[model samples]
Target chain A: MRPDFGLLLINLGINNTVYVKTDPREIALLEGLAKDDRQAIETIYKQHYNMVQTLIINNNGSADDARDVFQEAMIVLYEKARSGTFELNCLLKTYIYSVCRRLWLKRLQQQQKFVSDIENVSETVPVEDELEAHGQRNTEFQMMEKAMQHIGEPCRSLLEAFYIQKRNMLDIAGHFGYTNADNAKNQKYKCLMRLKKLFFAAYKNNTP
Target chain B: MEEMQLLDAVERYLNNEMPADEKAFFEQLRKTNPEVDQLVVEHSMFLQQMDRFSDWKQYKATLHDVHSELLETGSIQEKAPRATVVQLWKKYQRVVAVAASIAGITALTISAIAYYFAPKPASEIQLLSRELANIKRTQTITDKKINALTGQASTRFIPPADPKSGGTGFLIDGKGYLVTSAHIVANADSVYIQNTKGDYFKVSTLYVNKQTDIAVLKIVDNRYQPIKNLPYALQKNLADLGEDVFTMGFPRTSTEIVYNKGYLSAKTGYNGDTTTYQLAISANPGNSGGPIFNHSGEVIGILSGKQTTAEGVVFSSRTRNIFTALHEIRKDSTNEDRIKLLLPSSIKGLDRIQQIKKIEDCMFMVIRY
Candidate 1:
């Protein structure tokens, strides 16, 4: 029975020549990644970080540079997977390698350093569309970050406590020294409006 | 004020915190007023951005944490040091070669002088036997001298000047069986345990397992009284990481039992040994065989040793090893008495002071001669 099942698997592998099938393990990891699971992200980072680190370090990049490029690629993959449009045309390893390569290449060119042919250590996948979407998302995220920086004082901390830390109003009230939750909630609303205005200003400036 | 109220309502509606009737009314208002509908749409988009922004920040934090952890564990390598180290080695080659020869000549000269002055033995086998006999004879003479000085008939005993080794141990069975580190009592002519009150009792080694570094002792002296119950139970299960733990031991320098508290840092010991746990507590020499207790007052592990080069990198033999050792002890039917482990610790709910008061009596200073 085991040999018969093995033969069936071989036939199935032979028949599925046109389309590259995704590994069930990779699918499970990507699904976990979408939910921002720390273990899944850690596993992926442990598995693929060395490959990306080696690629970058071999091409006139330092370990810190390798870390930055790899992390940016991770963000791209994370956002794409979370957006629910990531289709596995290639293995996750190959895709991450390609993304890291493209990201490092762009970084090197931007710095106007002397360029040479980068060694392709793995199979390549065309992730230009995915990268473009990530770029737009990154711009918006940066705008939000800038707005948060300029939001200032207790307001910034207040908004962070509510939105980022996801603390409830009562806890925020006690932590921020508000007499009641209603006062904290009101302060949070005012802070949110100011943050929205600042974010939009950066958004409009970037578009034009 | 009016705009704040509207914004609050819109946020509540977006978060699905609105009541059924109020939500229905809000939906009708959205249909009738294009301005309110636009506000709802805009707020929803902003809320989505906020959600993603939080996630992005959190994911970045996780990546940073994982990177640092992996680096600490040596799972990943940094590239900058390697290139720089190679260049530095090349530049210092001549200087290193010159220093190496000078050091080598100095070491050889020192060894030559030492070898010239060293005593020669008649034969290797005879010398080994003679040295062993000499050590035993000297130890016996010292023991006799100390006993004469202290007067052996007294209930209180003074510690000898030179002991073979010393460590802490605790009672495992109320029937006078105590557990201690095997290294403490592994090779000894006599073993004695002194309580905090300075009362001493002679004990004989019952079983010693060098593999787990655990030894069992039974008090044979008539001066010892068997307690009816032990306050703390030996924990059978593995303890969780980051649980608060405290230990009491007689560090060699201190006469009194020193109490120290720390937490379990890792589930495994040095080099991932499953039978031990890595703790973040600082331990000194003579702290071996001390009981590591959790906050709830159960004996979780036996304090074993510490990494010499690092601070607070202590390792403890897990309490379950005692169980495994006892299983082996039970299999040997020649052992007449049964070693019953204490269960249902009485000190479970007590505060630290009360718990220590009840437990301090069971802790003993093991001195080997």
Candidate 2:
């Protein structure tokens, strides 16, 4: 049997989920991405890969370049969702394109690889703060990555299930094969404590 | 503030469960107290980091699918061309050149696959008997050890050890006596015991029993001592075949302790060897000599080795084997101080997770060079 790649975990308590329109669907996609849902992410890739590809290719890049930009944008979106701070202020598709645009432009500038065409386009000029904030976010996110890889499970998995996946207390309890639900909660706290110790210790010690 | 309370407050603050007044108070504290401020930032970063990890895992999976899809179906029909066709025509030449190169790369890839599949001799296949659990994977963790101003605190990505050899061991006493599989240290020129906290201590072999395959070691440094009370009692009731059993060990050299669960699947060892029990737990290469604990946190067996062809059927030397060896060493008048260190565990009635917490600190990864 094929594994179901996504679990549609909606924190939206009210409003029955019958309407599979844009917002709820995006929320589901974001949540699915948080859950690391394969199909949801593939749908996203299929939807946006070409958009990013066309932009990069038109601006003197290749299909491979497009793939990288799209993947990178997906990572940024995934980071936003994983942070549990994602609110559907804009459509997911629109946000992805803008992010890809920013990323591609930044890369092109860094490498000084491309010429014009992306410049005169009336897309919202990304501000200094926005660029700086994105840079800061990327650096901090990278630091977090280093510290987390050093952490082993079930501490690692517990934290992921809670903060990233937003899985409820009981389901996490079952997943880790804990003796009971209460133990799972306590263990989650313990794991969090350990994570804080690991993360901050590495944070203070990390020069970058 | 107290450390535990500080941790508790950090949790409450992050979970947003603090009362309105408390939230205001904590925010005030965050301004005045640097520790609380650091804690708050660290907590948020931890959440983001954990989420990033989850995303990367799923993201990698989708990326893999896309790579395959692109390879097979050739770019999924280009998504209806949002850009103007005139601009696209102007851009198509450069893209065409890139596409030609990509096609050349694909041809090279197909040839590479053909070369990779070219088969050779049956003599290349030999059943490997040496069950060494060295960290085999190429480690991406660049920094070997994390150094604080005060001391060495973090050892990242299982520091460099002989890629050929490694094994597991557990602290039998607070004064630094450890019990591991004989095969781990029996052939080692130099041995280092790395704790879960990433502290490495040199260890000298105190004893190694060849037949039973149990070895003991004493930590070289005098300052280091583990938990005073051994986390598990040495309870050797091997009567029941189906008992809750678990092991904590470094199954691979590069990672920290891994915990696996299963039942005592059989009475005899491999090929009906009497000194061991057939545990249903999947004992990997590096798990040799790890303490096998029952649900009550009793040391029922010392995990030895697993058969090559079987899955989840590993052998663990019964606690009785260790006891018999200890008795013989006493009779032969081995150093009196050597026997003094081994102690019965004081912990009991703890469930699985609790047992793990207590026992995890007591286990160490033996990095042999």
What is every candidate's alpha-carbon RMSD to the true fold? Answer: 33.9, 40.0
Candidate 2 Cα lDDT to native = 0.73
Q: Give the per-residue lDDT of model 2 (tens digit) for B30-106.
A: 99999789877866766656665555656766776775686467654443333567776676979989999999999
DockQ result, candidate 2: 0.13
Which residue runs of candidate 1 sit more than 4 Å off their true CA positions?
A: A1-19, A114-116, B81-369
On residues B1-369, what C-alpha lDDT tens digit does candidate 1 reach at each position? Answer: 888899899989999999999999999999999999999999999989999999999999988998998889887777662475665788799999999999999999999999997776567679899899999999999999989977865666565657888999999997899999989998899999988987778899988988778889999887688899899998867899999999999995445989999999999998999989999997888999999999989998998899987887999988988998888889999988699989788999899999999999999999999
Give the DockQ-based CAPRI class for model 2: incorrect
Candidate 1 pairs with clashing backbones:
none
lDDT of 2 at B118: 67
What's the CA error at residue A67 for candidate 2, in Å?
63
How do all models score by TM-score?
0.47, 0.37
Candidate 1's interface RMSD, please? 1.9
Residue B211's lDDT in candidate 1: 74
lDDT of 2 at B78: 43
Model 2, position B196: C-alpha lDDT score: 85
| TM-scores of the candidates, chain A only | 0.86, 0.53
What C-alpha lDDT values do all the predictions have? Answer: 0.88, 0.73
